[model samples]
Target: MTLIVGHRGARGEAPENTLASFAKALAAGVTRVELDLHLSADRQLMVIHDPTLKRTTGVRGKVAQHSAEDLQRIDARLGLPGWPEPCPIPTLEQVFGTFPDIEHYQLEVKSGSTAQSRIVLAAILQLVERFGLQNRVVVTSSSRTLLRTARDTAYPLATGLVEEYGLLDPLKSARRYQCRFLILKWTLCRPTLIQQAQAQGLHVSVWTVNEIEQMQRLIDMGVDSIITDYPHLAMRVLA
Candidate 1:
């Protein structure tokens, strides 16, 4: 069976990455979830998709520039389902606290594999340790070097390689980084590729899948997990 991972916490039902979104996904019966992480100015690890806050938060600054206090006051759900109701951006700590039973959390780090981003990885590792989610989470990133650094940290969490720029053989990067998962874009999730990756002992997780036809196709192809904006629809499709 294909595991349904709520993309940005059932983004179709609620604002992306907000607590309300996560609650809706759980209500939709999704146990696995995919979220993005960016470090804030005050060193708080924030759970949001972009390094910049323009798209989601409607603010005109980078997430790393805002302190936790300032970020808390911003209404992340500007015009979404819970408009004007103050859905402040949540910390990874808050996420773990609210949903103790979330089985698999695929966290994508938004920073590149640069030297300075090591701080970002370190912060994430600390949070994972604090919440005891090291075993239940997969830290995914497009940067192979960053993943290598993460692996060197001796953290037990699974590492995943996110496909970028239409990577021809994402498995190569996964192998290089010793990643257990291949985070494929929906377009790259072909049956042959899925089978090949699985045959080589790699789990394939496709992302941003929302269409019923595509979901059914991926399920038929035997994907290990499907990250989607609509978990309720995914559940029905699987059913």
Candidate 2:
């Protein structure tokens, strides 16, 4: 059975990556939660997507430039449509604690130096150990170095995200990182790709699939998981 993951915690219905969204996704029956992580200025692993707070938070600044103390006050909801004001930016550990029942976490490690990635991976691993989620997490990234770091750290599940635009052997890349799965953007994926990955003993998961037709196509193709902003709708479609 294909796993249904709530991309950024049911982003379509609630704020992406917020505790609220994660709770909603869990309530809606998603088997997994996909979230992005970045290092705060204080070197804490937090769960905001962009390198800068501009898009989601409406705060104009690099996330790495701000300390966790400063970021906590920045109001994460500045640009998100409806709000009395803004919401607090959540730390990765907080998100992990919120949905202990939904064990699988598709963790995207955003860019940083190799040293930075190691610290972030270590922090995540510590959280997994603390929560007993080692069996439930998959660390992933577009950066091969970051993926390799996670793999070296012995994360039970790791994935390398492949761009749809480029011509590259995803299986070979997964092999290089010793990853258990390969994640691809929607436009860059096809059923054949899923089959190929599976044939190589690697699992396949695709991201940001919003349309029903595309979701149906990938699910029909037997992807191991579908990462989407709307887990409620995806669950219904899968049902």
Candidate 3:
């Protein structure tokens, strides 16, 4: 069966990357979730998609400019109307603690440079190890440097390559990085590519797929998983 991974924790249903969003995904019977990570001013692993706060938090600063404690206090319910409650930005540690039994976690590291990517990946791996989730987590990133760092790390955590534009040679890069998954943008998924990736022992996971027809197409194409904003809808369609 094709697995359904909630994108940024049921983003269409709740505030993206917030604890409430994750809970919503869980309630929708999603066992896998995909979330983004950024390093805070205090160098903590924070669960958020954008490097800036304007879109999600309606604030006028970069995520790295604020400490984790401060970031958590800011409400992240900017885009979604009638949310009815404040949804604080969560830490990677908090997510792991709250959803310990989740079948899989696709932790996408959003970094600007190789140096910062390494720093964030190190912190993420340390937390994964601390929580004994090395086997359950796949550290994914669009940054080649970050993926390279993950490949070189001695930690047993799995790594994945997130290809947004198909600019790079996806297969070659994934093979070079020894990634366990090739997370492609929904627009870039094709049956041949999916077959090739699967043949090479890389699980193909498509991202940001929200439409039912598109979801069915990817599922029929034999993709391992689809990352969607509406897990509830996906669940109903799958059922």
Candidate 4:
């Protein structure tokens, strides 16, 4: 069966990157929960999709500028159904603590800055070791350098997130990094690209795909996994 990865943990149904959203994704039967990580001012790995909290949380400025304590004071603006308590931005440790049974996790390193990248990488590696989850987590990023760093590390699985359509030979990069998968942006995907990736003995997947028709189309094209905002909707479509 094709793997169903919940993008930002049922983002369409709950606040992105919150524990509540992750629980919702698991409840929806999503095998993997995909989330982005940003390093805080104090080098704590915090789970949030955007570089700035302004868009989603009604806050201003970059996530890396604030310490974890400062982030805790900020509300995550949880707008999910039946949510009765206030939700704070969760740390990477908190996420693993809450969801021990999740089969796989796709951790996207969002910051491209040098210090931020190293800190984020170290923090994630620490967590993986702490939780004994080396075999269950995958590190991925659109930046070749960041992906290379993560891949070069001892992380069990690493993947390159390809968003460029004109990039020369993404498969080669994936192979160079020893990545287990190549995550393609939906717009740049084609049957040929999927076939090429598979022929190279690499796993293929796509991201941020919503809508039943699109999901079905990718499934028909033989995508190994699809990252979607609505895991429940994906389940219905797959059914």
Candidate 5:
């Protein structure tokens, strides 16, 4: 059976990447969730997607420029309607604390384009060790260098490669990183690719899928996991 992984914590139902959104996903019976990470000025792993706060929180500045305590004040509702007011940014530690029952988590590290971005990998690895979630989390990045850094940390953790768009050979990429999972872009997922990856011992997990038809298609393709903004739709389609 294909498992549903909430995209940015049920992004279609609630604000993206917030505790409220994650809670909604878990309530919908989603055992896994996908989230993004950026380093705060104090080096805390903030859970918002964008490097700048303009899009999500409307706070106009680089996320790395603000201290965690300061970033907590801005609302991350992304100005969407119906969500509670003052939806502050959530730390990775906060998300882990709030939803301890989630079976699996896919965390994408959004850092700078270069090697400097790996600065947060050590912190994330430390948290994974502290939380005892070493087996439950997969750290991924589109940047191979950063992904390698995570794999080579003092306490290395499970690693996955977020394909650079839809073109890279999933099986080869997984082998290169020694990644057990491949975060395949939703559109790139096909039965042939899924079969090929699986044959190579790589579990294929497609991302950001929402439509029922597409969800059903992926399920039929036998993907190991489907990451969707609408976990409800994925559940229904699979059901």
Candidate 6:
């Protein structure tokens, strides 16, 4: 069966990367979820998409500038006016704590430098180990440095190469990094590429797929998972 991974924990339904968003995804019967990670000023792993807080939190500073405590208290519901509740940014630990039984987690690390990537990866691995979720998590990143760092870890951490554009040789990069998954931008998903990735023992997962027709097409192409903003809609369509 093709798994449905909630994109930023059902981003279409609730504020992205917030606890409320994750809860909404779970409520829609999604077992797999995808969220982004960035290090705060205190070097804590925070669940948020952008390096800057202006998009989600309406703040002027970068995510790395704020402490995890301060980030968690800020309202993340900027574009989603329907959601009256204050959706605070969550720490990765808090997410794991709240949804311990989630089948899988795709944690996308947002790091610009190799040093920062190493620090983030170490923190993530430590948390995964503490939760006994080493088998349940796949550390994903667009940065080759980050993926390489994850691949080199002593822990058997599964890593995924996230390709937003087909700019790089994705298959070669994925193979080079020994990634188990190739997460492609939905537009980059094609039958031959998908098949090639699968033949190389890589699971193909596409991101931000919201339309039912497109979802069905990808499912027909035999994708391992569809990372969608509406898990509920995907569930119904897939069912």
Top candidate when judged by lDDT against the true structure: 6
For each candidate in turn, the TM-score is 0.94, 0.92, 0.97, 0.91, 0.94, 0.97
lDDT of model 2 at position 112: 66
Write down the TM-score for model 1: 0.94
Q: Any residue pairs clashing in model 4, and if so which?
A: none
Q: How far out, in Å, is residue 144 in model 3?
A: 0.7
What's the alpha carbon RMSD for model 1?
Answer: 1.7
Candidate 1, residues 1-239: lDDT per residue as tens digits? 78999999989888889898899899999999999888788888788887888777789999889997788777788537455466889988789899987887998985565574578777877888888887898889887677888777764678898995564578777887788999898988777889989988988999889999999989999999999999999999999
lDDT of 6 by residue, 70-160 (tens): 9989899994777888989899999999997688999998657778877888898899999999889999988888877766764378999
List the candidate 3 regions with Cα displacement exceeding 4 Å.
none
Report the lDDT of model 1 for residue 73: 77
Q: Which of the two candidates, 2 or 5, achieves a greater TM-score against the reference?
A: 5
Per-residue lDDT for 214 in model 4? 93
Q: What is the C-alpha lDDT of each candidate?
A: 0.84, 0.80, 0.89, 0.81, 0.83, 0.90
Backbone clash pairs for candidate 5 read: none
Superposition TM-score, candidate 4 onto the true structure: 0.91
Clashing pairs in 2: none
lDDT of 5 at 160: 82
* CA error at residue 45 for candidate 5, angstroms: 0.2
lDDT tens per residue, model 2, 1-239: 88898988888878777777788898888868888898888888878888889988887889889988787777776434785545788888777776678878888886766788788888887888888887788888888778777667775545556445547777778887887878888786776777888998877888888889988988888988888998889999899
- Candidate 5 local lDDT, 1-239, one digit each (tens): 89999999989988998888899899888989999999888999999888889988766889999999998877899746678665789999999988888998999985464456556777887888899998998888787777666556533677787874766666776787788788888878778888988898877889878888888888889999989998887788877
Candidate 4 lDDT over residue span 2-36, tens digit each: 78999989898888888878988999988698888
Total residue pair clashes for candidate 1:
0
Any idea what lDDT model 5 has?
A: 0.83
